[model samples]
Target: MANTRAAWARSHAKLDSDTIADAIRPLVEADPSIKVKSIITEVQSRFNYTVSYRKAWLTKQKSVVKVFGDWKVSYQTLPVWLKAMTAKMPRSRVQIKTLPVYRESEEVQGVRVLHRVFWSFYPCIVAFRHCKPLVQVDGTHLYRKYKGALLVAIAQDGNQNIVPVAFAIVEGETADAWEFFLTNLRRYVVTIDGVGIISDRHNSIDAAIARSNGYSRTEQEYNKNYQRLQERGEAYMHWCDEIGVDRWVLAFDGGHRWGHMMTNLVECINSVMKGARNLPVTAIVRFTFYRLNELFTRKSAEAHEHVRNGFTYSEFATKRVEESFRRAGSIVVNRFDRRNEVFEVREMPDGSIYTINLAQRHCDCGHFQVERLPCRHVLACCANQRLDWQVYVHDVYKMSKICKVYRGEFVPMGDPSTWAPYEGAKVIANWTLRRTIKGRPKSTRYLNEMYSRDMRGSRRCTTCGKEGHSRSRCPQHAGPSSTGGQS
Candidate 1:
């Protein structure tokens, strides 16, 4: 048995691993010529009869080391390899400095972090003595990856252009964030007495002001204004009073503070940036700069036209009005109950204003918010009354704001030569495979004769079940005329 196994091994052994393995597999199978030793049942096992040559061959086989083909390898392997390769490459360093670190009630020295920085110039109001009377402030959510919100402080300039003085991005829209943003913003905006600051009725600013007032020596004057919080917003007024921050009584819009008054310049800014909302962080900032440049361009043209048309910023009418109408006293204060869609219009009487009810479909003002134009109550009264509803409109709802922005000139950014459309994007054809037509049997004599005959045939109308005609030409389709047969 040992001699026979040796002879088998000699004949099967080949030059390469694959050929030797293939040749030995068949000999190990069940056979009559050699009595199988049955030392191992598995075909993968080699040489049941102990042999030195087979042992050496197995040892030198390199253990079938698996060098996996690219397709079979896991995706992470390439990156690991690349990282290893890059470790051999070189890099450079620049600056070093010392700074104070505050931690665990101790001051420690730390290297100062340096950034590649540049200076930017923003138009700021150093003195508010003769500045515009209206200051509009608003907050916007940052567009891209950075999780933060931006507070924009804007005002209408001499050219009727929205001048963004200072803006900041905070971690969140909390009172702390708003206070931090506003404290910095106030440094840029010079507020004159009687100048109204227009902003959403945010509690943070109120809370911060309240905190400041609490620390102020004039607590009596602050408490009087604090009592007026109830008149501002029932919820906000209560909240402010509870927090002891009630000094900004005159700072609010009286009725539905949101509806009658709020600064919507940020809304206009957002509308201008709607096209670039989903862009990358760098792109959004770049686009914002571009939009600013466009605003300046339009303002430059408007400035030239201002001199030609004798126009001033105050003379520029944001709202259209008909000539020959008195805008005062026409506005009757009205309350709209959205739940019931009813409007209660109050007209001032001898002592108090007289109240009238107008349903949702009909306002005493006589206008539905349809077409977004003021109705008669709003038109005759609000427009006639000189009341502004522009404040109540949510930032996104303003169509004119969006329309005016896109109309501004914008140069396409980046090099035209490097720009390329998505690669290999083909219009995929929705191909529907048509079933092959079963060839009609060669016209048999029996069918030909039957169909050809004018009156006699097996074919019949499927609908009416009449003989000698198909459903398409049935007499019922033609109408109850002479007969079922065609002419």
Candidate 2:
């Protein structure tokens, strides 16, 4: 019997999703966003066996649960966790709306399903005050078990750093949802008057903006940097036709766009945070905490080092101002104001002349007022008069302000075992939104002929030669089939 059992064990062994998940627990704990293809290669390397794509995907889901806890429980504990976070870091704002649950004819007691949520960390709230007074808003789809849309607001620092200000999770980009997100964003994050909001002209956003004066932050506030934007021809005219030409056309904006051409700032933040969209709700929030904390800590230290190195302006401002100084040396200045602030500056040899107003921080070239930085003409005017040119540079460009942008640090969230008991209604999930079918759920997107063709002839991954996310984002940078130099 012992000889027969030994022969059977040598011939066969069981491979399952649970076993795969257990094997990759360390990798998942280290990096929760590790790719499934990496898991398959790792399992094969360890056990001398392979697993199917579906099983690998299942193992990932299980591993995520092991590392970050269950998705359903994440929803239930979200409010409690948020309360603890708020207590630890004062002034952090969070609003959660839950719909009441019902059974037959009677209402459920102390039970509710999540409707929407909005959060703005205190550090981000503080950071915005020191950034450029322009805000960019955008939304991206969430592809987890609970389908939702993440609305994000981003601001840009003097050094051109991306500052994520606020975020919200909603059912979709419906008018109501946009209204909720925009209203809260205006009230909480972008509280300054005369600030500009940059966004794509999505119909839902338009509808929400039209519904009330208080909805979108773009309620007649100005855009400053008209000269910097490279105007697109047809779409520019079409956008003018749809929403009054004032919003898109910088001619109407009173120098508030701040050298930004489009809504790329928010789009950039969306890409940076989209990797965690498929994570559990609590994990998504946790990911934000870790990501933003890392960002602030690094930037804060960098800003201090720059200050210690005797940098009065941010690196971005320093580079631009230095170039302006070089150009100012050659340009000839003609005094126009008795205060020695305003002048007409001409280029070296023979060139067109530009008007500069040091007091107003204006230039006929439009660089001074729009960018809030001293243009060549302004520098030339100041140099001809022997006046200090640093006075013309905006405070936002100063290293001191840049340091304040990241001064707020995130507090570590202690263990949950010490958390105070929550007194709010117990949260429930809307089961109707769950993918209740079998196996992996199919995309609900209506596949046209072109999409179908692409699906049929899809290309495989470059790194592992497997069909999925790209090489950089993929964990398996190389596969067994890849041949290279000596190991």
Candidate 3:
């Protein structure tokens, strides 16, 4: 049996690279995380053929490039791809900005290098017209040969579905880059007035919005406010003064923003595009187009089916309303005014009182005002007055509005062979932006408060029988006389 196995293994050891790559292409495309060792093992287990690690690695690389296209070529083909996309979908907007190449401080006249690219599909822009007026903007770094930042503007439709409206690839996250992105966004996609923008407390965002809005406040006046803010240790107040609270803060947004305080919506979209960010520029754009197409189709069908089934509210809103209704049963309500719109609600068990103002669509508890949905107090008041609770629900949460958001269809970009010839200058990446550090690239996300957990209790040192440091790094094991030396 050993002799027979040896002969079989020897015969299968020299597997053809092309054959191995062909067999692994589907697996690689299905999961980019598959290791070379795992591919070799899988090949052996599935095909009963042995392969070397180098061949497996090369095969994976070749298959990936073949499937996703080469990185440099993808950059070169960006202009053509954008032109083809716009031609296929005329309503879609695409803008490419380039700067002349500089050689040792002197510009190489007329030789342009890619500086930024901005685009918004027709379907996305049209869908946003029917969605909420609030938009969340955020930026994430690109993990590729030519390092850059991807800026995204995402909005939540009536169904609470994230609709990506615009995307921009910039040299980096700076004031000018954000200004360029938001300016184009305003000109192309979000043309409606009173549209609220939400983002983090990043300084660049503040400067960009101020510049875009053309704030004419004098520097001395601004400096006075800044000094006062610093003295009071109110940095957020300073930001609000500079960028206008209506643009970033939820309270001052006057219901235009619909109470979205964070850019988590755009961040969610960024996380969804994690794998694609490592691809070349054209591939990244293609991935987004295809992914959004899938999302629009799936969500539109869902909304249509829900409406057909007679659902007035979204699944999420329905669940929340039902939960509030149940909680309303335990509360007591007393009408305070002649119109019966103002009421005092008291929790039976705790004797906690809350003021509910149905006229203003607000409650002292704040949930009703922020969520635009009746809170338990408001629901209790409505129940006591025999008023319909459905009227308190926002129209944006209705199934009809949701269907309208997904009604627009995403047109397909036809075959590349049928594309019009790009008559403009070739757009090449800025060489200065290329990563020069010599080390293996890190694909892991930076640790944040949300993703981090207190693992101190789980960490136990085998050397000292203590918590915190590992056995290899344990101080007890680091001593010269300790038998358990550092590994």
Highest TM-score, which number? 2
TM-score of each: 0.33, 0.80, 0.75
lDDT of each: 0.38, 0.78, 0.78
lDDT of 2 by residue, 208-274 (tens): 2333321112323323222111142444335435675456544345678886656778888777776
Q: What is the lDDT of residue 23 in candidate 3?
A: 82
> Which ranking of candidates, highest lDDT first?
2, 3, 1
CA lDDT for candidate 1: 0.38
Of the two candidates 2 and 3, the one with more favorable lDDT, higher being better, is 2
- Candidate 3 structure quality by residue, lDDT tens digits, 103-175: 8999776457889999999989888887888899988898747789999999897667899999999998899
Q: Between candidates 1 and 2, which one is better according to TM-score?
A: 2
True-structure RMSD for candidate 1: 30.3
The residue-level lDDT of candidate 3 at 40 comes to 88
lDDT of 3 at 287: 81
Ranking by TM-score: 2, 3, 1
Q: Write the per-residue lDDT of candidate 1 for residues 1-487, one digit (tens) a residue.
A: 5345334544444534444334444442222112123222322355342334443344222221111112112111222222222232211111111133346967544312111111111312321222244567776664322344555666554224566545443444678766755655454354343445667765365554444433322234445654554455678556655533222332222111112133566578766555443332233344444556566566556555544664322232323223213442444555445442334444445323322232223332212321223333444333423446443232222333322322333334345243333232111111121113322223455666555756464775544556677746755555556474568
Once model 3 is optimally superposed onto the true structure by TM-score, how far is the C-alpha of residue 142 displaced, in angstroms?
A: 1.7
- Distance (Å) between predicted and true CA of 266, model 3? 2.8
